[model samples]
Target: MTQVPTGETVTAAEFRLFKTRSFSRHFNRTLHISVYEIHRDHSNRQPELTLLDHESIQAGDEGWLVFDVTAASNHWLLNAKYNAGLRLYVENDEGQSIDPSLAGILGRRAPRSKQPFMVTFFQANRNQIRSTRAVKQLKKRQQKKHSDLPHPNKLPGVFDHVHVPDGRQVCKRHELYVSFRDLGWLDWVIAPQGYSAFYCEGECSFPLDSCMNATNHAILQSLVHLMKPESVPKACCAPTKLSATSVLYYDNNNNVILKKHRNMVVKSCGCH
Candidate 1:
């Protein structure tokens, strides 16, 4: 276990050591919350960061050097963990050393979900930006053409409507998931701002029968219509660009529809 003095300057080597620590749920008395880099998932091109309790502090080059506040004493633990501009100390587990202050939490908040919102993990390449640029670019183009993509910025009651805890906006995308449980009045749950889709799976009470994989614009619109007269498509829908790999066909009325073949899963809503 590493010990950080209350007030001191931490060396570069010390900061590296402070970061590689692990986490232990059972702290002797109090626990100071800190962040450490672990791994990133290549499938979804997102980072996988975890918290480090006081006991897990050891020598390694993976985390940040931050002030150690007893978990019991800090009434703002939840808030601090999620808020920006927390202090960091660079030093060994014990002994006097230099402490440096840094901006915000170490890495983005890890993705968390409400009950019944199980994690459907996605992988990302080691070089996330390079690996996921196409998907992001495609979505960006779509958003540009169709300005009415459902987003938190446009939605009046984003936090209230989806049951996201207040003050959790600072949390990272990976650290949050939206809830649709008992939301029967919702004809459409627009994908939160910036994300490509919003999920409503796992034994939900809402009418999400047709929206099993609501990834693209067409599926989302279909979901709105699926709700029928009760549907309240709060956000407007726009014509989506279908991929070349998909075969386009016309229905009995000659309405163009995308074949149910490729399931393009883009970024989904998270705490951020």
Candidate 2:
């Protein structure tokens, strides 16, 4: 039901389930989630199962059902012994005989696009980029030091700060044209090799204007921050609006598939 955070590095994990063509009750189904790990239970030799997050979703349309599993993924990264994957169970309402959600698209028979997948984001080390020509030009121009190395404070629902205090810079969107071919993804992606995804950047201060798309709660939070300072924080520049991107890539079966990846593109950004 919510979009995952895209941080400076791989600070988040998102589980995307392609829920377009599912054999189940479509209107409103309760999706229960859980993660599997290593367990030492004496009663049985089953893997350790830990519950994660759940939400109601409609499966009638061709879209992605995203889930935040950052903690689970981080745990796996920290210890390999506990990385057994996860499960999504759809509860049947009114005892309608919805059978075990063997409904999940699994095994080698499943289509690559329809099968569940995870999306991750990361960035280069600051020390690695300090010697680049771009860095030299930015240094020559004397751009703000913070812009080069930002330790963004994480915020809820796709919002993250640039670590620029007092919001001196204007909050605005930036152009980010992504080219699959340039990224050497031409082996898989077959059509519309690139797209302008754009992104939200810069800093925004209080008394946000019409362009900032400040919510009522954000306005109140700003006022509270001004009064108490430490109790609350200012809003961050983020994507207030987003759109899906249609990807034409090859599946595991070596078939060219065109699918719409939800929230794949950032359309318009605002201070939120």
Candidate 3:
């Protein structure tokens, strides 16, 4: 494993939820959620690395996640000799775990051109709000601002971050537009295959909700692309049941706290 550079702060990456497609409205309006990592060091007996959650509510029709890698690197796990690794988890307002049916999440590493992670765009609403017209308009504006760019891919800028376009707290329509440039680079290691539920194949034109195997296959493409072309991790595995010794609690001030107990173990399917 490559050694991470030692410093007061290693690179801080943000995995923001660039896009989401929600076919099942299970968490539609009632969704108040948090995204965080269950990270671990690279030792043979990999120890658990813990971090707080990035909380967000659905602003409009779309749900967004803005996860900070700095929180995961507080203990300097980023500098470990063996590559540090983590898995993503989503929790609801009630603190119960929610499945990927809620939304197919697409995560982009900040400040790097690394491939995006775990997305199906299963029931993605493309034509309605995030139409080609809107995307092109945004892209054209972005190109004008960044004229010197070589290959012009759609990039997110300050203008696209507007939650409320017309100054309304809630709007009838909402859309998200982003590019690889906006999300820079990854600070820590990620095992792409473990996040199978969140990915979809590039050639997968069919939406497979009924067939679990096909569904997993489609989404597995997202994580697979995260890895190099020569190394694609396993696409299928039985979901592991996590046993947590600590629970996430909120103080009187609504601050999140990791309430600990005796023993804790964190496991992801890949990159252990």
How many clashes show up per model? 30, 0, 15
Write candidate 1's Cα lDDT for 1-272 as tens digits.
01212332222111111232333322221223343333333466644544333333323223333322233112222243432322222333343332221211223232221111100111223311110100011111112123344432222111212212222322111222323334441233222222233231222111112222223453344234322313433222221222222334456675766553443332332110
- Candidate 2 backbone collisions, by pair: none
Candidate 1 lDDT: 0.27
Q: Sort the predicted structures by TM-score, highest score first.
A: 2, 3, 1
Candidate 2: count the clashes. Answer: 0
- lDDT tens readout by residue for model 3, 144-235: 33223211122221112212212322211122232223344121212111111221121211111112222334334423432222355423
Model 1 CA deviation exceeding 4 Å by range:
1-59, 63-88, 101-272
TM-score of 1: 0.19
Model 2 lDDT per residue over 12-129, tens place: 5666655544556442354333333333333666655666666554333344456677677677656657665675555544423333234343432445324555544333344211
Best by lDDT: 2
> Please, what is the TM-score per model?
0.19, 0.38, 0.31
lDDT of 3 at 69: 51
Residue 113 lDDT, candidate 3, scale 0-100: 21
lDDT value for model 2 = 0.52
Model 3 regions more than 4 Å off: 1-11, 21-23, 37-49, 74-78, 107-272
